[model samples]
Target: MALAKLGEGANTGCMTQTDDSLRDHFLVASPYLEDAGFHGAVVYLCEHSAEGAMGIVVNQPLEITVGEVLDQLDIRRERPDQPVYAGGPVQTERGFVLHRTGGDWHGTIPVSDRISLTVSRDVLEAIGRGDGPRQYLMALGYSGWGEGQLEEELASNSWLVTPADDDLLFRTPDESRYAGVLRAMGIDLNQLTNTVGHA
Candidate 1:
């Protein structure tokens, strides 16, 4: 669903819906999103269907350190070294928790149930206590797809889609997610053209 919004460029316009009809796909950036907020973004397809897809830009790390945000909330990182991600352009001041599930810590968005998104403040407090999920990434915003938006993008190849892995979501280094997702598709970053437009 994240790639469905590829209407912003050319590669998306040339794609056909049949190109990808599977579940839990990843959106691989084309190496040209120069915007500091989205440069080399990697998104996770949470939902993809005829209605359209919705995703979260998981790998775009923001200059805002987790420790800094903690200060904003009057809390401090249990581990000062934790990284903070851009999430997306929405709710830059809000927080979203992308974390491992099936643990004793309940109450989440139940993205896949196995993988959940928590927008609650409690997650933050839990993190401060060092009693949160096994692994997690904190993001400032999120990405969304409207009905029919993703389908059109798939036809244009704006987003190179591939399977999603929980390990990758929780463990992949933020700096490498964009290219890393492409690697999952066995693609070379140099092979993608920066030319974006509707074919």
Candidate 2:
């Protein structure tokens, strides 16, 4: 949602990726994306097949009420409580689950057969009642790539491919996520830049 932006509109400088291989990779926005939701962002690639690519911004946390989202689905929580995450720049009203599978959950998107995304309000209700999945995250909206868009950006050095880690998803705090990923890469925060074409 707009909360992820903390800005007034879409970034005029966001580079589109144009390579096939980079589709399933992650985009760690350079220090140059420092004015909005993308500032120091770390995106996780959810799809990278021939058709298209998709992901979610992992670092930005929103101030929205998860209960509000549940209510939209007509599911009520006996005791509402759970943090909401900024997924990306698509349908902010829709719900997406980035979590481990099982335990009475429904309406999931299979990121991998082993790992899935459950987006229905039932999941949220269960979570609010302390009966949610073993581990999960609620994301509103998502980042999408069409055809050659991701490839173009990857060729320009706009993203980095890394294995998605559960610890990074569930344990890291919002403020430090992007920096943490860079640290894992043995790169210092001072070394990245927004100039993708030259990188």
- Give Cα-based local distance difference scores for all models: 0.62, 0.64
Candidate 2 lDDT over 48-115, as tens digits, reads 65556778787777886666666655665665556678888887756676777566554555565445
| lDDT of candidate 1 over 63-177, digit per residue (tens) | 7776676677787567755778776775465566777764443335455556766655666667777776778887776666567776666566556667778867878787677
Runs of candidate 2 with Cα error greater than 4 angstroms are 1-25, 31-37, 71-74, 78-80, 193-199
Clashes (N, CA, C under 3 Å) per candidate: 14, 11
Best by lDDT, which number? 2
- In model 1, what is the error at residue 154, expressed in angstroms? 1.4
**Model 2 C-alpha lDDT versus the unseen true structure:** 0.64
Residue 11's lDDT within candidate 2 is: 20
Per-candidate TM-scores read: 0.75, 0.75
RMSD of 2: 7.7
Model 2 Cα shift for residue 23 (angstroms): 7.9
